[model samples]
Target chain A: MKKKLVLYLLFPISFVACDNPAPEKKTEKIHLEKVNSNTDILAENPEIKLVGSRGFSYDFNDERFMQFYDLPVKNLHISIVDDQQHIQRLAMDLPKDKEAVNTLKTQLNKAYGQPGEDAGNDFSAFEEGDVLVWKGKDRLIAMITSKDFATAAKIEKAPKIDILFVKPEETNN
Target chain B: MNKLYTGALLGLAIAASSCGSKKIKIESINNRQQLDSVIALLPKTQVKVDSIPVRVLYMHLKGDFTFYGQPVKEFSIQTKDEQLQACTFDIEKGASDVLQQLENENGTGFKEYSNPILSWSTLPKKIQFSVQDFDGDLLTLSNKEKAAISLYFNNPVNNRITNIYKEIPPVTTTNDYQLEVDNSECGYRLYVNDFLVIDHAGARTLGVTADINPYLVKGKQQKVTVELLPGNDYDGNPRNRLHLESVVHVALKKSSKRSMFSSVVFDFRTPNADSMVREDAHSSRYIRASKFYGQLSAKVDHPFETDAVPYELPCYAAAVTDIRTIPDAKEKILAHYRKLQQAYLEKDSLQLEKLLYPLEKNLQTAWYWSKPIDGQTRWTNIMDKAREARDVKLEENVVLYTTPDGHFAKLLPAVYNKNPAFYLSKEDGFYPLDYYVNIDKNGDVQFAID
Candidate 1:
């Protein structure tokens, strides 16, 4: 009887568990969907694909991001995530002079403060015609590519991809 | 075991959260304090930010009075912005308050109050006060009154008092030599014939003397008039502020004529001996001698024969002799011809004429050459023709005659030889001798015979 009782209890418990169907592990899929959607949005707007950070994917149509790109900036990008989040994507369109790339790096450092230990070590040279990618915030991504790097060996050899995570103003405190 | 482990993990998580929250709270308070201190240091004069008491003292004294028997009350304190802040006092509240406080502290007579004292001092981080004693009495008020007296502290901390004293200029006169009457603290207007010469403005304390040269013309007296246009009486009392004790009447005499001639003789001595010799020989001796001889001879005979007489003859005889009837007439004629030769040699007529007679034919020839040709031949034809002929000359005997020294007569050939066109007009007279003689309408000779 006890065995039957145990079996019955186990059967109902299993049935209940089966009925629930182990909440589909949608975390990775949800994050993937968010990244895909953001990528689509970014692709639609050239300015967004140019400024993506590591783990965090951003909406290309954000008004603040648009305002930032509209500013008189050269080799400019939005780094949504940094080395802290492990995913890094750099997007940039640089001017002809290597000095311009250096200047952009310096400005980024000053604006975002120094890169922390998690930020993917130091910036590396961008491959020929390859868009640079960097890590930024959680699920935030950064990408940079420069048209000027094509002909400029020095600039193309070591193009600076500034990766930064920008937190929402409300979240900064 | 799993439950216990989960519970312990949760507890640790809670403790960590609390620690983080506490640290954030403490950090926030520290930041707030630092920000407050920074705001305080900033230069903020806005009334809302800070309020400081500003005490202004005003003293109104009746008439000019003496403080401690010394002439005072004229002194005024002017703010840096030229605002009149304070003046002397009669029944001064601020002075009385300070004096009473001092007296109460130091019983009765305060030795330092002998003189009418005006002094100021600042309390450390507290207040600044100024004291003025009218009766030279310091100890008069009680301690309670002293403490209650509203002391004027340095509000702006940069307040500066510029003492302004009355500036009474001496009496002045107008350019037209008239007395200038200025009876107002404000300056006067100086005018000549009612035309404004100078607009003296904002001159206080009256009677400012000015030395001005208006360039008035001599012999004519200008009516210099001055109208006293009063300035703004800053004291609010205009009565007796500007007193014209007397209008000074001064006459400016016209500058005397300056002499052109220098009292000291200027040395014009020629540096070159050669130049000196040339001027002395050519200008002084020969020219003067030739002039003398020509005048003397012109008085006696016709132009043609006057020069035939020898230069060695007595002065009167050489001047009066008739060469037409002279003894040794042939010799004189030869001598006259030789003079022409000598003229060519010396290049001087004055010298030649003194030694020989003037050739009548030569004079006639010169006279004919002096006439102007037709229009087409005016310049080139006449002058060119005259220059080519050696003997061709002007009919002016004064020009033709030479001195015995051969110096002065040298200039004549140069004149006639230069441009015949100039002398070849009817407008030019025939006898060049007429130029030398100072003959008036009466025909009386005024030649220098000596």
Candidate 2:
């Protein structure tokens, strides 16, 4: 009789234990060019700031950022979570100089694996054309769009970094 | 057994919670005795913090007598959601007067604020208190505004004798200048035409004098009002109670042809006949006579025809003391210009540096450049500008703009010489820069620019 009582209690207890499992912590992937695993980088580094938003422009003599290269990056737009001061997106206006662009591309090639092959990858993250992209396992993608080679010193017009990155999945795990 | 112990500990931790995380703070100043007593009477606990007195003594001016209220720093509790809660004060017993927070005419906060003393004559002195923003949720009071507050007041602490002055001014004439005031333990401000002439602190109503001529224009009678500011008047106490004296006007004998004086001086003292022998050095003259307490105030009258020139420093008379007044200012300026060229041609830095001219206090000067490369905020050394000038050479056609009185001129180089055109000032002599090079009449540098 005692054995039957123990058996009945053991079956229900085992069933209840198996019914629930601990939730796994999900991680988000963010890699562009030489930059991979930006999870902690975005959390720690302060967002870059630009005074003007109407159009793209950069000045070499701007004393705002002493650490960054003074010449190439024309402008930047930082995405923050809601009204809280949490940075989500980081975009930079690439330099007009071809040499600087090539150097940046070389670094990106090492990290994102030689850019995607998709032709005119404006909206899609497919591998083609001059639009290079790297897709992640967790549905996060980093995209880069390169223009025809122009010498950094001879670039007559000031250029805008209009390329944008979007999250593939609706829920940012 | 260990598992049971862990569960028991967790249950205990869940049951035991902190009393609170928010509190109110109050700081007492000025009247510490009454403030301490009031705070002692109020309820404050572990969760409810009330008062924290920072020990800092305020500096007092020697002869000032306005009794501004003691500021009390008070803060309302802030909730978890970051909202300020309403806070009020409770006074068990003490003398008190609330200083209302200064607000603009529209009742909004004003940038320029003075700690205002308010009195409810009808209310009892002990329970006087003010509520700061009863409906608003934001508690952003400035340190000055916070400390400008007074929570309570106790009466006996501020010992004051009210209605002490009985014998006051009744009917007085212009010639009847003597005003005998009762000998009180406090001092008073004597105002004529709303201007404070006498802020006197003395024991007896004995001989004291001041010249009130500065407040009067020629031929116009001034209305006088006097206020007695006591040393210990705060918290609606009887100490600040001012028994305003009666208003009286002194008339002057009309003159058909009064001299229009440029400068006037009034001697409030009862001048002795012996001292009046030689001419009074001070051009100020007393046209009206009046006395308060032991002091007399002098009123000087100037002629209506002559315009009164305000006092200015670095003036022509005051600056040109080293030599007799220059008969021809234009000749002197031109001669100085030629000397300046000689110094520059010689590349003589020392001589160029010495191109300094004496300036009287408040000397008026200007530049000839249309978009003058200069604006002087303070006294600037002319030598510095001379040194900054890259190349100094004489230009053709020196343009001279003479002063209104022709006593001074400003010299500018030829207009086409686009170099930082040195249009130095010409006051008695050529000043290579602005005011500092100009010496006062005493041959001392006392020049300043506005």
lDDT of each: 0.27, 0.30
TM-score of 1: 0.13
Give lDDT for model 2: 0.30
Q: Who wins the lDDT comparison?
A: 2
Report DockQ per prediction, comma-separated.
0.00, 0.00
TM-score of chain B alone in model 1: 0.14
What's the i-RMS for candidate 2 in angstroms? 29.6
- lDDT per residue for candidate 2 within A13-130, as digits (tens), equals 2211211232332222222222322222333222212232111221212122221222334234444333222234444445445666566656545644555543334434432214
lDDT of 1: 0.27
> How well does candidate 2 score on lDDT at residue B43?
39
The window of 10 residues in a row where model 2 chain B has the poorest summed lDDT is B158-167
